[model samples]
Each structure stands twice: as C-alpha cells, then as structure tokens.
Target: MGKMKRILYFRHDKIGDFVLAWPALAMLKRALPEASIEVFVTPVVASLAEACPYVDHIILDTGDDKAIRAQIAERNYDGIVMARSQVRTMFLVRGLGVPYVVAPKLHWYQYCYKHRVNIQMGEGEPVWRKGCRLTERLLRDNDIPIPSLPTQYWDLSAERPKWQAFYQKQADSQLVFVHAGTGGSSGSLPTSHFVSLIRQIHEQTEQPCQFVLTYSGEERKLAEEIHQALADTPVNVALAPPLDKLVDFAKSLVAADMFIAGSTGPLHLAGLHDVPTVGFYAARRSAVHVKWQTLSQAHKRLSFTPPPGRRDGRNMALVDVDLAASKVAAFLNQDQGK
Candidate 1:
C-alpha cells in the first residue's frame, strides 16, 4: 500500500491483448513511479511489452505453471498482478507466496462466463473487456496502483521519415490500406472476401487507389493472392514488411486516408493513430473484437451479422464492397474538407 518497490505483471495472450494491457501498465507506472515493473508475457508478445517504457523487464514464458513458479522463485517480487485470469496463472501467483498479489476474485470469473461473448467467433465463447475491468478492480481493491486506459503510445516523430518513404513509393494518387489478416490467428476474414472487396474498391475509386496488403509470416500467402487477383486492376497491392519494422508500418497506416481491415490488432493501432478505419466484423467475435476506442470520430465499423448458429464462422455478407468503398471515400472527403 505504501509503495511497490518491485512488481510483476502477467499477460499471457496475443499481441492485441498485450497492447490493450497498455492502459493498465500506464496507470501502475503513474501510481508507483519508482517501482521496478516486470512483465511475464507470452513469447509472441514479449517484444511488444519490452518496448513499453512503463515495463522495466519482461519475463518471456507461455504461462506454464512450472516456468512461472521457477521464475517467481528466482525473483523477490513485492507485488504480483495478472492481467490474464486463467486458472494456471492464478495458482502460479498464489503459490509464489508474494506479500501482495492482485487478481480477480473467483466470483468475477463466473460473472465473465455468464456475460462474456466469444469475440474471436472461433472454437468457444468469447471473452469481453468486462474481464479486464474486473481484473483492474481487483488490483485496485488490493491497494495496487492502477493505470489509465491504453491509448496510442508511439514515438511518431522518429517514424515520420520511414512512413514518408513508404508513401513516396506508392503511386501518385489516393491510397487505401486493406488489412485482411489477423495476427497468426484463425479468427480472420476469408481471403476470397478480401480479394473481392479490394476489386470492388478499385472499380469504385478509379483514382488508382493503391492497395497496401498488410500481413506477416505465413499470412503473406494471403497478401500474394490478393495481389495476383488484382494484377490486372489499377490497384497496387503490396505486403507489409516484417514485424521488426512495425513502427514504420504503423506510421504508414496513420498517414493513409482510410483503412479497411477486419477486427484485429492493426485496427486498434489505426484507431489510436486517428486513422479513419472501416472494419469488417465477422460475427459475435467481430462485435466484441472491433476497436471500441477511436481518436477520430469519423471511423466506421461495417459488421456482418452472421446467421444464427453460423455465428462462429465468417458467414455474414452484410457489408458489401461497394458500401465499404463509399464509406471510405466519404471519410476521406470529410478529411479533405477539414
């Protein structure tokens, strides 16, 4: 309660989850300016947390009980906070015997299970931000300093030139980025849908709307397919670079007139950067996964209401490509008017 000299924050999730946890971290740092904050994150998102200024150290592990126990045993942490509410994470921290531990109570899980919807619309039911709110409440109840909501935190000044370079290579015309990929996950829009959408956007916006096909790793295949499909069209399609150069990629997204993507990490990034985004919602997951916070009021969400029982898959055809292009064009025109 007095001061947390040493603390541990645990988040075993994807890149988007880590990014969402930024708000909580910022609150903690503000409350305990001198506290040495360490994070236990999944290896995939470890680098992102390490990049956070509020985090002093990052413990990269997959939230395994033995690994967590071993890591805690080696460190003399004064407080422990788990952003994730998995049973394994709970037991691991409880076993650590830390003097001050923060986690949601057992009852909060029941509440979450009852009200939560599967945002991914994949295998099981969705989890909502309500769980995160519960976790933050628990931390506050335990006398830990909570952080503010996660917003955009970037050194854009350093990234401007990189973005300009990418933009310069683009055709001398209006450019729109269509992000149809998720972060190495199954809950993404179909490639066919993306290709169809891009083709439609090109026809509607005959101004040679360059298509920035942002993707990574194995997902690059999807981008390539989109390029091949639009080979004859005036639209120019290109894949986003590797993860190490994400700052530049993010900068490019911010500079774009409009972004058309599915509910994913980049959507949140776009929202944070004040980029007008048109998100294609897959279903129940899409409803929950889409960015709830937007720096710009002009952002739009084009959700597809999947048929009942078919809610788990990308079955909805509620948003047509023509509508999406119209929205993007309107958003860009509004920006120009400003």
Candidate 2:
C-alpha cells in the first residue's frame, strides 16, 4: 500500500445496499482526493453508480470472473474493500495482485482479507455507517485522515429543479410519494395495505396535496388496484410517470415534499435529497429499525417496524396502518401549504 494512487471498492449487490454505500464511497474519494477510486457493481445499479460524483470509474460485474479479474489486475489497485461479501468475490480477490483486501468479519469465507472489520450486523447503527466505518478503519490504519461525510453524493442539480418547478405551480401543493415495491427483498406490505394507507393520507392530510404511487413491473397490477380503489376519492392518486432509466426516478425524488416506502432502494433514493421519508420495516428483517433508516434529516423521517417476540409482529398484514397514517397526516399538516 505504498503511496497508494488507486483503490477498488466492491459492492456488487442489491439496490438499497448499494445506494447506502454511496456515503462510504464519498468518504473514500474525499480523503484520497488524488487517488483514482473505482467501484465494482452489478448492472441493476449501474445507472446510479454512474450518477455518483465520487468514483471515477465503474466496473460492471457481469458474472464473468476471469474478465473481471483481468480488469482488476490491470487497474493496479492498491487495495480493495469487500463491502458486500459474496462467494464469487471471495475467490475473485484471493491470490489477486491487489496489495490489501478489506471486508466485514462475518462470513465463513472471510479470512482472506488483511483488514477485517467486525460490522455488528444487528446493532442499531445504520448499514451505511458500518460501510463508512470500514472506510474509516482502512484510512486511519494507514494514517489517512477520514473526512466527514458529505450532505449528499448523488447529484440531482439538473433533475431536481425540473420536478420542483412542477410542484410549485399548485400553490404549495405537497407532493407525496408512495412506493409499493420491495425490489425482491422481504418484509413488504401488500398493495392492499398501501391502498388503505394512501386513502388515509388523502382523507387525513391537512392541506391539498398530490400523491404519486410508484411500483415496478411486477407490482403494476397492485398499483392499478390501488389506483382503482382511490379513483373516486377527493385526493388524486397518479402512477409515477414511467421513466426510461432508474437514475431518472432517483433524480425525481428531490422534488418530493414527502416520500413513503418500505425499507427499499427508492426510499434510500429519497434520502439522497434529504426528502422526508416514512419507511415500513418488518421485525423479521431485524427491522434494526435504526439500521435501515433513510438518509434524510433526522426529524423528517419516520419508521414503522413490527415488534419482536409477538406472533403478529412478524406478519406484514398485522402492521398498524392507522397509526402510520395519523402520524403522516400530522406531519403533512406541518407543511407550509398555501
């Protein structure tokens, strides 16, 4: 690691997990301003990765180990961090020319790393904080000063104002978003739950507001069902405009007065702009309620997690919809609506 000029941070994983690592990437780039920082990611999050201003290059993990290793070797990275550990990544980095390797000290196949960090999985600290701690450890051990995390890393300067302008025309019409998809992860409520929640928000909100419902390809029917149920309501329920790219949706979040979703990627995207967020996390997922908190202003975010040890707590259907809606409406009332 002598005079390190280049480094690689590997996080070829889920969308939410990858989005959370944005701050860690920012810390690394800020501390090592002169160094070339590269990231390894899967195609699903490639658009967001490319949107990141911290990293200089993006390495697509196309499941081709041989070609990936070749690319890694040529880059001559001084070190690599296994932010998201996998069996494929374990073998890929083993015996590679990279001088140092770092990874969370959890998995059975974790001994390969020279710098192993014990990231307490169930601890209440955010996953992104653990990821940043990994960067801090690597930098501090090598006597590098870790800079404080940035206010935000995803640059929405071009996209945010466009959406913001649209919301401004309606005389402080609060733009609230509800994303019903889990992105294939667990502990998500059904569309029926979202429909009920949306209705409550509409009837309960103190001011006039526009609501947007977001879903993926698989949840179209559910979105339709929710829309159909709310069609006759006083509040308008509109489907999120279809976007050509994931980055576009991420950018659009900056315009939101409030965003609601499960502990999923889109919720974290709302965090990028410090948008007020309401997240539904299930206890079965350890609802490390604090662990999965959105990256928004502390007072602005709210979370609902099923309590442990209770039979109903683990059931997504048993979540308290009324409580969530009441709190949401109360928050909506605080908005400076004309």
Candidate 3:
C-alpha cells in the first residue's frame, strides 16, 4: 500500500495504436499523480509520447533484448501495465521480474501478468476504453480509486497560435483538410473521390473554402493525383508539409477547421484537437463506427460507411462521393451555425 515510485507501461505499436491509448495513459496520470509513469513505445510513435502529457517519461523500444533488460533493471519500476501486449514484451517483463504486472487476459501470455483483466476486442468496446479497463483493473486490485474517463488529450495550446498565425492568410476561408491515403491499414477512397469531395465542398459553400491534402512521403503520388484532378476547379489546393517528423505533422492539423480521413492516425489527431472531422470507414465490424470511432464530440464529427450488406473491403470506396460531400457540407454548415 506504500506510494509506488515508478511504473512501466507498454504501447509500442503504430501511430494509431498509441493515439487510441492516450486517454488511458491520461487516466493513469490523473489517478496517480505522484507515480512516475514511463511508457515504452516504438520509435515510430516516440514523438507522440513526447507530445503526450500523461507519462512522466518515454522509453524507446530499440528491439534489443539486452538493452531493454538493462534499461528496465536500472529503472526498478514498481508496477507495469501492458496496454498493447506482445509476446516479446511479456517475455521481457517476466525476465525482469517486475513485482506488479498487469495486462489484458485476452493475449496468449496472460499468465505473465500478476494482475490480468478480461478484455474483449470488438464493436462492444472501443480500443481506448479497453486500455482504460486494464488500468482500472490494476488500480482497483491495489485499492486505488479509479479516475473518470478521458474524452480527449492533446497539448496544442502552445502550437495552436503558431498555426493560427501561419494560416491567417486564409482566416476568412474555412480550412478543409483532407487525407487521401489510408496508410494501408483499411480501405481507402479512390483518388478521384477525394478530388470530387474537395470540389463539392467548394461548390456547396458560400464563402471561400481552402483545401489542403496531407499525405506520407510514400503517398506523394496519391496527393499529386488529387491535386491534378482539382486543377480545373477554383478551390485552392495545397499539399501538407513534409510529415517526416510526427510532432510537426501534429502541429499542422491544428490549423485546420475540418478534416476528412479514413480510419487512420490523422483522424485521431484531429479528434485530439477537437477539429470538426468526417471519417470514412469500411462496413466490416472491426472497421465500423463502434470500434474505430473518433473521440471528437458528436456535433463536431461525422462517420460514414456503406450500407449494411455492402460494408466490406473496398466497399468503403463505393461510398458515394456526392452523398459524402453533402454530409460534409451539412456538418461544416452546422459548425458555422448557419
């Protein structure tokens, strides 16, 4: 029952995985303000951990077993939480012999956790909430009071002004940011669909609306194709800055008033910033609204999927661009209170 000094947490996954773990990490911070919570994350999402205020420290997972063991032994953490469980991580924790370990019981290495919570991954509960449950189970087992759920988490106050100043030129116009690439996680809309969506947003709006297309370096071709398709339209089209650095790319999302993306990391970033967003998704249960839904407020966000029977694979691409555009128009107008 003594005050725990240091706690180790694991979420060494992709950008989207870490994004979904944000609220749970924030909950841990709030409930045990005195504990030094350090998260082990992959290099791909280290920037996000650096940006997150939830954890006191971030340990990069370099994939070297010896190095990882040395780091863990030196820290002498009091407790550990495996939010995103992996066999390697379980083996590492077991070898280090951390006194208190917690993880979801759904994994193959459930016995490795000293404290395990039954967690199910499906439409029944969000992935983020599942993380929170693991944390809650750990706290309850130790007689600690659980904190309220976190709806969103982002430290953008410092960066928002910079974005505002940079986008002041188009201050009069509604900024509609769109990401045409899906990072190959789920289904993506056709390049022509994005082009049509951008044009439709422009045509449906009364005032000027500027559109920015954001993409990864590998997705430059897709961005260029969307840009080329918009050539005949009056709508202003600009490519988002290089996203080589995660923090810089995160800052860029703050300047946008509205964002359109598939089930991806950027959509979660927009949700964190409370930017009005519209997300496209496949009809599959895993990809539907119940599982990959955004944390953004209902009034500020929209989720679109194909009809019940057609919701599968590339079926999301069949989501009528004109219909999706109409929904986007309505959502933006509501934000304007028009």
Candidate 4:
C-alpha cells in the first residue's frame, strides 16, 4: 500500500448480485477519491453498472480468457477486489498480476489474495451488508480509511419521470407490479398461485388496482399462463413492455407502486427504488427469509416449506396464496395513505 492509484473490482454475475455490491463499491470510491475505479461485470449487468455513480469505467466480462487478460493488462490496476468470488475471476486477477487483490476468505482461493476477508456464509447479515463489511475489512487491513456508504444506491432521477408517466396512466389506482417467473436462483410459486394471487388482489382491493406481469424471454409462457387464467377477472393482467437491457428493466421499476415476486433480480431492483414489495421464498437455510429477503422496510416475505425441514426446494407453491394476498394488499394500502 503506497496509496494505490487505480483499482478494478469484479462482480461478473446476475443483476441482483451486481446491485448488492453497490454499497461496497461506493465505499471504495469514497475512501479513495483520487483512484480510478473500474468494474468488470457480465454483459447482462454491464448497463446497470454503467448507471452507478461510483464506477468510473465498465469492463464487460467477455468470458474469453485471452481477451480479459489483455483488457486487464492494459489497465494495470494497483488493486483488484472480488465482490462475488469465483475461481475464474481469481485466475483473471492472477493473470493481470495486480499487485494487491482482496476477496473473501471463504474458499481455497484465499491464498491468491494479498488481503483476505474472513467471512462465513449465512452469517446473519444480508448479502449486501456482508459485501459492505467485507470491503470495509479489506480496506482496514490495508490501512485505508473507510468512508460513508449509502444503504441503497440507484440513479433513477433521469428515468423517474419516464416511469412516473407509466404509473400516471393509472391515476389514483394502485399499480402493483408482479413477477411470477423465477430467475432460477430460488424456488418459484406455481403459475396457478400467481393467477390466484391476482384474482385475490382484485377482490381484496375492490378493483382499485392494476396488475402487470413482468417476465423474461424464458418466462413468457408462465406470464401468458397467468394472463390467460385471469382472462375473466375484472383486473387486467398486462405484460410488461419488452425489456432488452438491464438499465431499462431497472428504470421501469420506478413506475411501480408495489412489487411482488420471489427472490429474484427484479425484486432486488425494486428494493433499490424503495418501492413497497412483497416476496415469496422457500424455507431452506440458504434461501431463508433473513438471507434472501428483499432489503426494503416496506416489504414482506412469506417463506414456506412443505415439512419445515425439507430442503428439496419444491415448496414455493406451499406459500399460502391467501396470506400473501393479504400482506400485499396491506403493503399497498400503507403506500396509499402516504
């Protein structure tokens, strides 16, 4: 540590994982204001990182070892940090030959880092909080002063009006955004559960709510299933507009009055927007409420498992639809009063 001039951080993962790393990245930039900080992210989340104020540059992880090495070698970063650890990323750090690298000490790859943050998985902290703590420890070990970091960070000011336009169409009606399709990270409720939830919301809210079913390319059928099933309901299940970019997808969330989903990328995105949300989750230790829950106070998580001890990950449908509907309705009402 002779006052590092440049740093590169890697978090080549999904949108949600990249979002969770925001606090740590912000802290790093705050602590070292003069240092050039760039992020190496997957193509899926590159645009989202581009919107972050903390990141000075965005390096897309092309997954080509030679290309990555060449790109990194050119940067000549003084330090590298892995917000989400991966063996390939470790090798990338090694190949670049960055003088100082920091990462969690949870894996065998700890030997490669000049600084290691000893952390246990599921240590009673949200993943984002864990990321912040890890970055803090890394900086502390290197005698770098820590700076304040926000609990959440997303620059939606430019897009806020754009999203507000979408919501304004509903006027005083509550706009509830629902994502029934799971991103394969955690268990998902059955399509029927979603259909039932929508039906219940319409009844409970007395038709004062509009519903939008957000889905990915692979989840079109699931979305359609709910749409078709609710064909006769007074509430219309509109499909969200085609979202081809992560930044656009995130911007679209600003229009939401409330969001409903399982533990997924969009759910996490809504949390960043401070949207009231309700999520469903499976009842496994790793996927438990505390670990995978949304990081928003105006949110609710309904965790369910068939036998409480079952870990097969097939119990998302077991989440009581009526219970979820009631909670979601309550959350929306709380926002209504404000």
- Point to the candidate with the largest TM-score: 3
- By TM-score, the better pick of 1 and 3 is 3
**Model 4 per-residue lDDT tens digits across residues 246-321:** 7878878877778888756888888777677676766665745566556555234434343355554567766778
lDDT of 3 by residue, 221-246 (tens): 99889998888778798877565688
Where is model 1 more than 4 Å wrong at Cα? 62-67, 106-139, 142-151, 155-157, 167-175, 182-192, 199-208, 241-257, 269-274, 289-314, 336-338
Q: Please give the lDDT score for candidate 2.
A: 0.80
**How high is each candidate's TM-score?**
0.74, 0.92, 0.93, 0.89
Predicted model with the maximum lDDT: 2
The local lDDT score (0 to 100) that residue 215 gets in candidate 1 is 72
- Would you list the C-alpha lDDT of every candidate in the order shown? 0.60, 0.80, 0.78, 0.75
Least lDDT summed over 10 consecutive residues: which range in candidate 1?
112-121
Candidate 1 TM-score, C-alpha based: 0.74
* Clash tally, candidates in order: 7, 0, 1, 0
Candidate 1 lDDT:
0.60
Residue-level lDDT tens digits of model 2 in 1-338: 47768889988888888888888988988899898888999999998888888888999999889999888888888878788887788887787767777888877888767789988765566778878878888898778888987665665666766886654425546788888876444477877888888888888877776888777777767777878888887877687777778887788888888999874788888998888899887675455557778788688888886656558665678778889999998988986452
Pairs of residues clashing in candidate 1: 23-150, 27-147, 117-126, 118-125, 118-126, 119-126, 119-285
